[model samples]
Target: MKFGLSLLFIIGFVAIHLLSRRMKFVRMVPRSRFLSIVGGISVAYVFLHLLPELGEYQEHLYGDIGNAFWSFLEHHIYLISMLGLAFFYGLEKIVKHSKRKNSKKTKSSTGIFWLHIGSFTIYNSIIGYLMIREEFSGAWGMFFFFVAMGVHFITNDKGLWEIHKEDYEKYGRWLLAVSIIAGWGIGAISEVNELIISFLVAFISGGIILNVMKEELPEERESSFTAFFIGLFTYSILLLLL
Candidate 1:
């Protein structure tokens, strides 16, 4: 059952990514926004928790929003990505402080944009980390995290594209560099594992984040040590799970 379910999940996504990205599924989503993205993550959280028992394929968190949201996030990130795009579109409507041009043009939203982002990360990260810790099970769950993470990446690609199309136009990519460094640095706030997996998680997380912020911003590379540090840590965790 475990093996079959894993295969089923993989095949299903293959069909969806290839046939459905351009399909009515994408079009039919009603709200198509970020809170909706949060809603998707919530569903994913529940699904993942249920998956292991279904397939006898136990797995834990994939460093997704941490624990609170991790259970299903790897499954739902695509929705989250789409929802994020929708959320931004909606924000364009309700935010009175939004820089609307008197005639047509608008100004770069430097202040509140960061404000929104800051709040989002803090609220999500705490919940997510607890979920990861909560998913403390044996190693069989490795397939659950790795495969889900792979699928999650594709969704991230969607989120990245949508966010770039809509928001980065104003912010300029400088924030990409700053935010990545900040996320990695802060996620590594623990001096305990500062040189270990924790820091790398922070760094790669920073990278995954900046990936969305990319193309619009100048390409920036982390130092070889930092890059390796982050990759090593990520792979290490993957191996641990597997």
Candidate 2:
């Protein structure tokens, strides 16, 4: 059952990447309320689900590492989470810089396009890996994860489409779609150290928060606060109930 469900999730994630460009409602001029809702759901998951999971991971890390050096960094897991956020934040800055420097260019430069895709490919892979390896209560937990991440991917796809345009359609989406499967395949083949999984969870939590924020917080996006609040509260309630 677990294996089957993991495969189902992999399909769902891949489909999101492959089909998000065709989601015409997502291409609105003032930005879509749906996207804002997506932002809220993603943020809610990071805070409600992933952050608590990070605390568990931190405990595991502390138990395992019991060294003086490790003791110095009491919030090492959180630091990793912050690192993940900062990494994506830096990437977003680079992308904005490129756009400003090439204001007349219709498509992002090849270098920037690849850099963006490459980074997201790794990000997607980590998500895929966690889908299989991360502990959950049962199907419901995984289902919530899938829902949050599925919507999150839509927002990410929209952002990437705006930046990369034709290149994203032609190449970038395909790579990201495959990356999920590739990561799942790795998970299926062999499990890595729990320590590594802990770090991955922390890192991805930060990345998700940053990625969602970058999409919603830009004044030009004209994001919908009401929609964002609805999504956040709805998902938060569901998570709490679970």
Candidate 3:
């Protein structure tokens, strides 16, 4: 089931990017509101589902580890979460600065654009890899996971397009698309320590929170309260009911 679903997700991920950026109808959709809804759903998943699961994974971390390190590990996932957020925040700043310096040119420097691609390749890869590591309790679990991530990837790709324009089209987008497949292959074949998986998840959650807000919350972006509220409550209700 997972093998089939993961393959579907990889294809869907690429298709969404194309539709969101290239299709006129999709481009006509209110992006701010759409992304806000996505942000809300992603946050719901983090708060309602992922965080609780992290607590369970924390328990599994105990074995022969000393008390101090165990204690540190317990408390430090949150800190690692903060680090993930900060890392992306700083990277975005650097990429933007690099882009600005080359704004007069047709494309940014290859070095600058590669930096952007490299960071987001890692980001997209994490989503693909997590498709395998995430334990979905039922069909709905997988559904929400796909929905949130599919929307999240669309939002992230839109942000990249805004920043890089043709440069992203020429170089970054295909690299990111390929990274998703690569990460899925790696996740399928390789097994990591569960504790490490937990940490990576926590970190990714933090990154998601930061990235979603960066795109959705800006004053320049006009957001639809109706759509945003619908997204929040609908996902919240699903989490509670299911």
All candidates: TM-score:
0.29, 0.96, 0.89
Put down candidate 3 lDDT per residue, 132-195, tens digits, no spaces. Answer: 7678876677778888888888778777777777878876778888888888888899977687
lDDT (CA) per prediction: 0.35, 0.90, 0.77
Q: How far in Å is the alpha carbon of 225 misplaced in model 3?
A: 3.9
**Which candidate ranks first by TM-score, i.e. highest?**
2
User: What local lDDT score does residue 34 receive in model 3, on the 0 to 100 scale?
Assistant: 64
Q: List residue ranges in candidate 1 displaced over 4 A.
A: 1-45, 48-108, 123-132, 146-157, 164-242
Per-residue accuracy of model 2 over 63-110 as CA lDDT, tens digit each: 566677766444677888999999999999999899889999987789
Candidate 1, after superposition: displacement of residue 193 in Å? 18
Cα-based RMSD of the predictions, in order? 16.2, 1.4, 2.4
- Give the alpha carbon lDDT tens digit for every residue of 1-242 in model 1: 53344344334433433332343333212323322232233224223432233222212224434456444643443344344445544543433345453223343244545654443344233222222322334435534443334333344334322333335333422333233334334433433321222322332333333332331122231123333334444444544444
Q: Which residue pairs clash in candidate 2?
A: none
lDDT of 1: 0.35
Per-candidate count of clashing residue pairs (backbone under 3 Å) = 17, 0, 0
Best by lDDT: 2
